[model samples]
Target: MIGTWVSILPPLIAIVMVLATKRVLLSLGSGILTAALLVASFAPVETVKHLWSALTVSFWADGELNTYNIFIMVFVLFLGIITAFVSLSGGSRAFADWAVRHIKTRRGAKLLTVFLGLLIFVDDYFNSLAVGQVSRPITDKHRISRAKLAYFIDSTSAPICVVSPISSWGAFLIGQLALILGTTTAVNYSPLSAFLMMAPMNFYVIATLAMVFFFAWTNIDFFTMKKHEEIAQKTGQLFDPEKEIPGQLKEDFPEHNYGRVLDLVAPILTLVAVTLGMMVWTGYRATQSLNIWAIFENTDVPLSLVTGGLIGTLLAAILYIAQMGRNETASYRLVGKALSTGVKAMMPAILILLLAWSLTYLIDILETGPFLSTVVEKSNIPVNFLPVIMFILAGLMAFSTGTSWGSFGILLPIAGTIMINAAPELLLPALSAVLAGAVFGDHCSPISDTTILSSTGAGSNHIDHVATQLPYALIAAAIASFGYIILGLTGSVWVGLIGVILSIVVLFTIWTVKSRRQIELTT
Candidate 1:
């Protein structure tokens, strides 16, 4: 029990440090170091020696240099490159221009922002930037806070990936499930099936989207936004100087003109069209080498993401050059500089990723999994409460690891085995529990790439974004946990119905309370 306390201290201490100091990277690094110290502190000298050996062994044993990891990295890099070109060539700007032309009202602008976020489900990385860049001008135009825009982008990024087929997330889920299933028989987890099955269970995600539409339509948030609105109304200034971008800056980069906006739009659309075609091509070509049963044998995640991103960037660049007459076209030197900038923007995300991976290793060294298993088995909770328990367990593990995929990798196998032995009928609910919890933890984690992107997208402080997002995520998770409990009692569809109803009620209640309070304060 004492050893278990030692195992858990690192992440807890780290969270406190982050909340207090607001330094994201420092907090994560301290957490990793603490986990290492815990392993060295509690275990015997011989055990410490063995642990050192195990660290080296595990590092070498890790298939990171394998084709799979390499492909995923390449995809991430390529996407960065593509996004750079989109930004440089004004593809993102062009899209923004077109959006502004069509979406005239503030309400229309916010709704379109959410819609565009859904549309960019091919990759979370793409979604963060594309949604942020294209919508920032319009959001600013309407006096919407960057914080709110970030919330929309952050919430939508993982939520969409977790739910949408034909994404890196979809591929990763298939690969992870296959890893656990062990037969390579194209187990029932196709991208589509996984999407449909998990979508209902994804209560936080579903609720968040519904909340976004409601808030966007109603202009309601309890704390910060409400206060800002009152201040604006009282002062006769619609735009808060603290929140708005300066007029001089806006003058330098004026809102969308048609030609400039088209310059951005054509290339991005081309990239998307080509990426889809490439995915189809890859799937088709893969069959030539492997049987249908082995559809995912050696399938590459990083490679797919990078390849799509790179191709999109290239097409975007070419279109930009064509749009710029020869004299004004991107020179080789300028193109190189732009590519460098693109890659540089990804540096923080890449560093966070490596650190996040190391953090997962730290949690393993801390023995989180066994500790969780012990606590759950000993708690004497009701049998029907198991799924809810699993959800909490999965969330803790994910928050500590800072990687939903890693959490899923470990817990899905355990949950799968448990379902087989303990309650076969509860299999889907258990699996759904794992997925929902993992995404929820990832969504809130300071070290998460999605979290990092949200800050970058909004140009808000990372801590500011984290602070604003937590309340919403936790509220949704509470509803989701109850939903899983209901599923445990009934079946999947019934649970979904209950979840949908509960989520709506919850969202509406929160908004109503917040809105009424604002009205009361104003009056």
Candidate 2:
């Protein structure tokens, strides 16, 4: 199948189908069925049966589902509950009030958003909702466009999660890496060690977090965002539909009468503590050693997350119950209601996560990874440009799929295989390129869950969020591409740092040019 060119058609068709139909489910289904048919060597009846089984059972079965995914899903569910309880307890509102007092200027507000987003590096969905909930009032007070606020929330979530060592995104990546490299000694570093090294090389993530400041501090806008900002400053019309109509949550927060800042802080602290403690326990269990480095390297991240997530939820519930102190039944009911609310809020995200995993499982059956590796290896492209190729292609796939996680699940394996076999030294840069591209693509994609959550959290018009964020994302992506090229040519991490600096310069230059053009138009 390495030389079998037909193998490439399924993913390509899936992407194209998405562009044409605007139906991810249909496109994914078509792609999966196509792969199954191919695997069946064009037996129509067998293909149908195979597709049915895959569609029905791939995400729940032993071979495909596995413990890691199960734990990840469970952790996600509990995390949703935690978010809801925090919001219901008035903890989020309380935190926002506290934070707003310190944020005297628009720059401070935006930076605070960045900081909060970074702090919630547990999961992407939680990051978007929590950060958006906390920062919106402050940004609105400073006349920042909802679009801009959405950009801040959206940019920080996935980008931060992907790089964090103890995050769900990190756990997912490790699980995938473990599958490929296995317990066998194929590489010198553990997956986590390699991930941390590649983290800095993630040009897009680095550029994105920095770009937020550039926009906030400079007060510059290079696209429609400028018009929205102007509208907000002039008319106080933040969610201006004339510019672009975008979808967002109807209600920002539930009508609640009680809550405190500590309600939020207590649960978050407990969560972090439990997570860390479990990591140590898992590490000790795995290696029977107290070596901190060894523990980190061998820690079972998914297990720790699930174990910690459940305890954290229960711990938060207890705090809420005690604080809400009333009749026993009333207190119990209050906590119970909040937990359910949180679970309900997370439903859409959970469904999307499941679908993304299912799609990946089906693609796995087609051996898309091996097929991609072969294609890259045999192509006429030079090794120096491989990172560039990977970034663009992976970005496109993510954009089409509306999911960075799914794209990573599909492309990382391919990228890893290609890098390991063709140029082992380039592994870190190559993996980073794939990761950066996936994040960039997900950032730009209208259908992405984080994008939707950002809009919802910021209370922005969904289309407006996408319209305004695209220019900023594209700016970061363009610079990231050049960074990859430089990394490829020089084969040096220092060269990658140079790329980041160049990206900032390019961004500032774009802002300057756009400002001049707007000034000229006014005159």
Candidate with the greatest TM-score versus the true structure = 1
Best-fitting candidate, scored by lDDT: 2
Q: How does candidate 2 fare on TM-score?
A: 0.73
Candidate 1 total steric clashes: 9
The C-alpha RMSD in Å for every predicted model, in order, reads: 5.7, 5.6
Q: In candidate 2, which residue pairs clash?
A: 89-259, 246-461, 246-462, 246-463, 247-462
Each model's lDDT comes to 0.64, 0.72
User: Distance (Å) between predicted and true CA of 485, model 2?
Assistant: 3.1
Candidate 1: where is the Cα deviation over 4 Å?
1-3, 39-94, 122-126, 171-198, 224-259, 287-299, 323-337, 457-460, 489-496, 506-510, 513-517, 520-523
Candidate 2 residue-wise lDDT, 1-523, digit = tens = 4226566666677656755764555665677777777877888888787676665562457656567766765776676677666665667677667666777777898788888888888667657755665577578777888988888889889999889876667767766666655533446777767878888898888888888777767677767898989889888888765432222222244445466777777776676678768877887898899866556557787787788778878877776667545423335566667666666655554554555455555555665554554566578787788888898877876765567877787778777787777777887688788889989988886556677667766767656777789888888888888888998999987787787787688768877788878889999
Every model's TM-score? 0.78, 0.73
Query: What is the RMSD of candidate 2?
Result: 5.6
